[model samples]
Target: MATVTFIPAPAPDHTASLRAAVRYGVLGLIVLAVVGSIVATLLAGMPGLYGALLGAAVGGGFILCTALGVLFTAKLPATTAGAVLLGTWLLKMILAITVLAILKPLDFYDKTALVLVIVLSLVIVLGAETYGVLGVKAPYVEPRAAGDAEPGEKDAQ
Candidate 1:
């Protein structure tokens, strides 16, 4: 004789949702960078190409940093994603500062263009991330009691 029990499959992970969102964000950023570069070339001549390259690098770096976080946390529980995020963010900041300092000595690119691209890409990526996170279905919702009284309202005697 044998006993059988059925269990439902686990729902998708929050990290997976976030990863997808980030990928979309990165794609958007790349497209924006390319288009912006072409437009810049018309407006400002040579600085546009340099700015495009800088934007591409920044977008790529964001993907790499996010990938590292996901890869490192693959085997760990989802609860630790926050820590991974914080750590990777710190690393990104350090890397950004170092890259800026190194690039400063080489007066090849327009600083204004590079900075503008970076900032614009950052906004796009952040928006994508926010959209992704807000769309996620949280594991649990706060339970509400039936007929709960409003805050600062006393129960009837």
Candidate 2:
């Protein structure tokens, strides 16, 4: 007869999903940016190329930054995380608005290309992030501990 030993699986890290999400989001944005740049270049030359690049940076960064903030704050308390997120959100909004306002008068980039890339990047990156997070396998229920009594039982004998 051969003796058998069972090895328990390592505990799952809760941050796995968040990390996966960020990775997918970054990859999606990069692909989208490259495609956008090529298409925009074909459509409007230098201006289109610039527009696509700028749009991708702005839109992708807007969402990616938030995910990163969340990941970084995962070890912190809920209240601290919330406060940091709120502050970051406000800063992003202000920065975005300021950037657009400054670029409003510039004719160096194609507005149509910029708008299209921004919209696409936002949607695609978000979808990719969602997919990544959902794909991660996480334990839904707590494992029973040795020596712990099951429900309805007074104590383990």
Candidate 3:
């Protein structure tokens, strides 16, 4: 008698759930950063240009942190992803504040124009991320058995 060892199949929707979570989490963070920048500017009573520059700096930093988070998550063990993201976010935040402070010495556009630029940059960054996520290819093809002919192809005798 021959013994057969059965292997368990992968969960039907595990990958789908993971992809959805990743896409939504990234999008949510992007939105939050933009909103935070807008609120901060409004509260500070800074001129539009200053607000715009500050917002742009913050948004750009968030995007960079996000990319690093994703990269680290992919390369490291699952247990470490959250910690990596936190560390990256903190570092980016510090750097962004520093840049904004240094740029204070330089004269840029007026307040309104600066605010518009910041808002536009945030929108553009979010749009890019959304499009990229939507473009991800889902693996749907199943492997064929040995000696089997593919669809529409004739088999050799």
How many clashes does each candidate structure show, in the order listed? 0, 0, 2
- In order, what is each prediction's RMSD in angstroms? 8.6, 2.4, 13.2
Listed in order, each prediction's TM-score against the native is: 0.65, 0.90, 0.48
Q: For candidate 1, lDDT tens digit of each residue in 72-109?
A: 67667667877888888998888888888888887667
Q: Model 2, range 1-157, lDDT digits (tens) per residue?
A: 9999998887678788899999999999999999999999998999999999999999999999999999999989999999999999999999999999998999999999989999999998999999989999877677788997887787534
- Predicted model with the maximum TM-score: 2
Best by lDDT: 2
Poorest lDDT segment (10 consecutive residues) of candidate 3: 12-21
lDDT of 3 at 41: 58
lDDT of each: 0.70, 0.93, 0.59
How far residue 93's Cα lies from its native spot in candidate 2, in Å, is: 0.5
CA displacement after TM-score superposition, residue 111 of candidate 2 (Å): 0.7
lDDT string for model 3 (1-157, tens) is 9999987565443244345434654565456446655655575544543565555656655564575466547657776977887788788778867875776666653444445555665666666556655555544576576798878677433
**Model 1 CA RMSD to the hidden true structure, in angstroms:** 8.6
